[model samples]
Target: MAYCKYHPLTASTYHCESCQINQCDHCVDDDPEHPEPRCFVCAGAVDSLGATDIAPFWRRLDRAFHYPMNKQTMMLIFIASLLASLGAFIGGITGFCLSLIVTAITTKYSFLCLQRTTDGGVTAPDMNEAFSGGFKIILHIIFILIGISLMIVGVERLFGGLASVLFSIFWMVCLPAVFINYARFEQIGPAINPIEIGRLVFTLGGAYLLLLLFIAIMIASVGTLHQILEEQVYFFSAILQSIVSYYYLIVIFHLMGYLIFQKQKILGFTSRLESSEHSAGRSSQNRMLANIDVLTKEGQFDGACATFKQGLQAFPTSYELHSRFFDFLYGLNKLDEIDAFWPTYLDLVGRQGRENQASTAYQRLLLLDKHYQPTSPDVRYRIAQACFEAGKSVLVVKLLNGLHRDDPQYKALIPAYELMAKALDDLPNKREQAEKLRRMMRQLAHHST
Candidate 1:
């Protein structure tokens, strides 16, 4: 949740270890040609800050449960479960192979869920994507499972039952990491590598422990439910178990995905959420603003001015663009240019009902050139009205003092006189003048009638 160094309002998702500064996604160089993100400041590879913007898996259990409740996911689960149930009903070596195929297919979908979720795509993927390439992950998972079983059996034979029990428990705890690693690299070697699994688990730390706790609870719950169904209704219990297993598979994979999302920076994966946020920050106005900042810093004032002018043209109503340009002009001491820009900026802010901005801009222009005044009668009146409301009685009187001489045909003359009269009434010795102004207002109203 660290804010970007350049734009304080935006959150940073990448950091430069060399510069020790956090950057928003859009502020860094994300060239597709270079897989790693490069820093805009030093062109060095940046570290991901990870999915700090998203909630942790433990905290989002409701979402995890509902993730597979979508129509497509439900349909997939039902169909897969029915196939597996049919395989069980067939009851032979052929039936066993059929069931294995169904298991592999479902496991593939579950792996797909984990992969997509890790990439910040929380929604269940289309059925087609799930079926397309999940068979490979199933093979990797089988290898991992077989490897764990053999290692446990070897430990029991060499070091006795206690050692085997400990090894079994260790592998049980490392199961999630094993699957996560496989999903990340999509390779059997890395998925089964002890170092890779340990690194991921260590990085996840307490959150991983929490994940294990949830997994244990889910497993126990599912087992108890299966037992209850088996005892009460022997006929449909297998089908029910298949349905429940598929549902929980989606949920667990989704939870794993969220875990990766929350730590994607450490995991070195860009998430859908991060990509989308970066894209959003690259709007034309923002790009222009960034360019202007760069041009100004490089001492290219003319080019910066040109870019700033183009930004104003492209996004005339952008308050940030106008404000930044005004500050830039003020910094350069370009009083003449600022004077030229002030009226348009003031009118724009006023039309947007920004009374404070209009008032502040006028006051700043006045300080730069005491004789400065907005030529438009409406702009002058609006500023005066704002001043009066802000209790700047003297400034209001100065602003409206000779309205008739300046613009005798100004439309809002009655309101101007009324505001002037109110300001005068607030002064100590101007009570008589205020009374005279009120009489003038009444005379003007009567004449208009």
Candidate 2:
């Protein structure tokens, strides 16, 4: 599976064939006029991604190894392949079944990871996900293979025929496209249907041909290495050959899938590829925020809010809309408004690791201004933690005191004493007081048990 070249944790939402890199939704630029999004590095449409716009393919060939699939996961897969190979040597029903099942499981699992990566998630799938699409993934491949087998059987022996050669060439060229469709939709109908398959190939045009050429070379190279290893006649060499072969098979599969993701706009699959929210252009966002600021200074809070809401309606994923509105509300002491839109406040700085700012927002909601109050234990604990981190031990104590008064056995208050002790311990004359609070924390812990 291909992950975002920028953030390894996040899966890729789109492939910028222009910059020759994968990007998550946060990094992609969608201008609404195009179905496929261009990355921030590419200034124009996805179609404008020409050879001059990207790095050489040879330099970027190492990106398949740059996936989020960690060494431990790949190591586990290698070990599984080793076991399956050993089992196949037994030559019975058990061995045959194990070999087929292991191959199916590994391929399905790899495809699941690819799908998840393109969907903009971060984590590589665990082993159980290999069984998720289950027999369906294997079945699609089997169906296509069966069809090819039938075609070759019917035509290969016919009178030194041109038809046999033509069919063989057709199957070879269309095989990658067939698997690409199957991987995306999980249906044999989509894979084997000639019209559907042909449309995808033509829509993708030279790109599909280039991808096929690349896959052919990639597999031939890996397979040639495996052939040399097998000729070495060593057990360890054979095991390593299996590992290399299957590993590159999955890599080629991902390359094919990324081709689809990059060309999804023309293929009408952009809805699946695009993120849930479409972000507006930066200039459009700047203009919207500027107008909102004008309305706010003119004492039209409702108009400012309405304009902000409309802009967000148009561009739900606009970070500036969220953060600028948060700052505007904060500047006006609009505590109720800020509290109402707390999620936007959190999302504004989500990618920036702004825990201190989040704590500050919680402080404003819980303590800074007394107008708006949240009355949940979870809320209060969050407020106390944020206040503690903000270095407001007094407010932390006040919030904890309220919780303790309401429920004398409130175990969460123990952390309040812990925070208080840490803050006091840093001061010159407060060591004894800090120790006293530590004792109180211990007493609470002991009594709670």
Candidate 3:
């Protein structure tokens, strides 16, 4: 037994002959018969993409944040994954092929997602564009897996039981290695080469362990959820379980790509665009926006306005900055200014598709000042519902009453009545108000019909 190369304290089960690196059971490809593990250089042709150095996991974690939470990107991942699941359900080679195609699609978009965000842009990747390279991707995966399988089986036969267990651990950690290689090169040869795989792992060092650990935990969590659902055996539980598991898979895959992005230099990958910090600093619009933020937070309204105007000068098309400026003006009761820009502000907010935020803002506007009128009927409808859920009964009633006063034929009165009924039933204090509301609701229902 030897100490593992990565975890020095741990006992090593196998040694990689090519790289002369020692690894424990957790690091080698599991083949029960293999006499010894081979390093990535021999396993796959090493890319020598980056140095063996990687930034601290905690440090890289922050810079890696932008790519993870793009709802649009997430939706794409989910849809691709869902399609893959549907394919698998078809239960044949056809199904397998379809699933593989979707896998390639998601992988392509996943990498494109990283490039777009890490290189200083924040746009959602187009779904069609992301799904562009399906057939080539499937071929790459097929070649890699088939080639790697031979190496793995031969090694297992040479070493037998103990080496088999160790190989299993190696296989576990190699998944990301395989993905990163193919995603970067889009080729079967490098991705499947054991040497390249080993080199990538060796370069990742301890962060690789952390990545492995996170993946294990994520899989275990999803499995545990599936088990719990299985125990209940509900009619829809299987569907729910499948959805949760596939979603987790997409997240883990995204995480794998992000790891590569975080350690790009060591992995030999390069961004085609400028670094984020340099780009942000060079942008006059960004500087002015930052200045406006600081000035506004300090209550320097005049200074904030000056900074806001400065940002607008350079970024005339930036609806994001324009929206923020409108927020500032709205806060300061500069209605004249807000009204002047209402068309633009509304257009931007509408185009941005944050109707929920707009609705909430509308709610707050009406709740704070009774004189304000909502631009849409749905505003009062949603706001009152939100207020009820938050236990703002007074506000709910007030909003409902005002809407009713404004229009006796208000559209959402039924939902409002149902909510009030529930409130009256649940709260003893509100029960007294319930009867009157019920009577009015009945009267309104009768008259409307």
Candidate 4:
């Protein structure tokens, strides 16, 4: 349970042997270009010292039971349950497809809950995050479940029902470990490896048994709810049952994820949260960028600008470096330098589809020169679209005005025309202009064909 050298309240995730200092995830150098996390000061390889201060999963049963009680998590449960209910009520090919979607979504979200919980995300994750990695996890879980089930069935056939029952019990005990491994590594082989499961089960000792007890209770509670609602309307009953099952499903996964988090040190596992934070640190170009940030903060604009000049040369295409440099120059009121840099900065942000940043940068440029226009038609098209989406219709029209004469070679003419038409329609007393743009769109379509 070593505390961070800089932030005493926070648990240290890495230790710099070179600096002989304990650094939290935030303080460690997270530059992705580097092979490993480096010390902020020394730029030397640091060893991962996993968090040891977390309470065991059993000790936090109250919080574990309420983990899925958040608005986001409950909403997921309701949506999945609603789909499951419809599938059960319809009971056909369409129903089967609906049911399959529910299963996939539920399984994906449950694993995400586990992973996020392991990463120190106390609250339930949003829907966007659950589907971020796609349905790959669904396949992995299916494989693990099928492989384990087959092993149990094979034991019954080769030995006896009693022997099979014993093996089932043994597997039931190791189930949490199996899932933790699966969530941790996201590979079926490590998850199903008997040796790995056995090692994990042994390492956790009595706490593993406590986790098993909670898991059994959570599983049985779902069945108990079904029985209690046996006399209710079938459709409504199905929905309730599904919701309860998903609620406990998330809780179970959260518990397993927390178990890993609590015992990360002994398990030699770095939770995803720590790893991601560690990686999000300054990059290989961090030293210069960091020095620039420090210098800018200290009101050493001259030195910061010097470093920015050097950094921009070294990492010419780096959006982050360019962004920070742009901000610094703007703060110093270096209008000429900003004018020279604006097009490149806008293009960098536009190419990345960073709509918000591009729009903000465009506004910043607008301040410098009221008639500011990017030299590149592509950059204009992107920023105009971004402004239009942000309800800056005037900006959109201004950006796209006279584009045909200026950059007729622009490949995105059709979309640009369509966007201009829409923006025109949105503006007051511009219907005639909008219709004219619409006619141009028709003419363009006719020509392209």
- How many clashing residue pairs appear in each of the predictions shown? 0, 0, 31, 1
- For model 2, name the residue pairs that clash: none
- Lowest summed lDDT window (length 10), candidate 2: 48-57
Over 1-449, each residue of candidate 1 has an lDDT whose tens digit, in order, gives: 68888778988888889988887766776655567767755668988766556777777899789999888999989888888888888879988988887877788888889988887776888877666555566767788888878889998999999999998887888999988887888777776666777888999999999988888888888899887887755436777888888998889888888898888767666565534545444566775676566456557799889889998888889888988888888778787787678677876777787767756766777777787766667767878888887778887887888886889788798899889999999988999999998888788788878
Which stretches of candidate 4 lie above 4 Å from their native place?
1-13, 23-48, 131-139, 156-161, 272-449
Report the Cα lDDT for candidate 1: 0.80
Across residues 199-240, which tens digit of lDDT does each residue of candidate 2 receive? 878887887788778777867887788767766756577577
The parts of candidate 3 lying over 4 Å away from their true place are 1-71, 77-101, 111-124, 156-168, 231-239, 265-449
Compared with the true structure, model 4 gives a TM-score of: 0.54
How much is the lDDT of residue 34 in candidate 3?
37
> What TM-score number comes out for model 2?
0.50
Span of 10 residues, lowest total lDDT, candidate 1 = 272-281
- Write candidate 3's Cα lDDT for 1-449 as tens digits: 34756667875544555666665433443232334223322442211112123345455544444444567656765666566667767859888877777777766666665445433233446767766776676676677777767767777899986776777667667977887777667667777777888998998787778888877887788788877787674535544655556455545555565566566666555432233223223344554564455346446688778777777666766877887887787788775565455455455555665434444554556554666654444555555565666666665565565455666666887777777576566665877787888888888888888
State, as a TM-score between 0 and 1, how close model 1 is to the true structure: 0.69
Candidate 4's error at 98, in angstroms?
0.6
TM-score of each: 0.69, 0.50, 0.44, 0.54
User: Which of the two candidates, 2 or 3, achieves a greater TM-score against the reference?
Assistant: 2
lDDT of 3: 0.61
lDDT of each: 0.80, 0.64, 0.61, 0.80
Q: Per-residue lDDT for 246-350 in model 4, tens only? A: 898998898888877777768766654443453555465775765565456547688778878888788877888988887887677676777577667766766
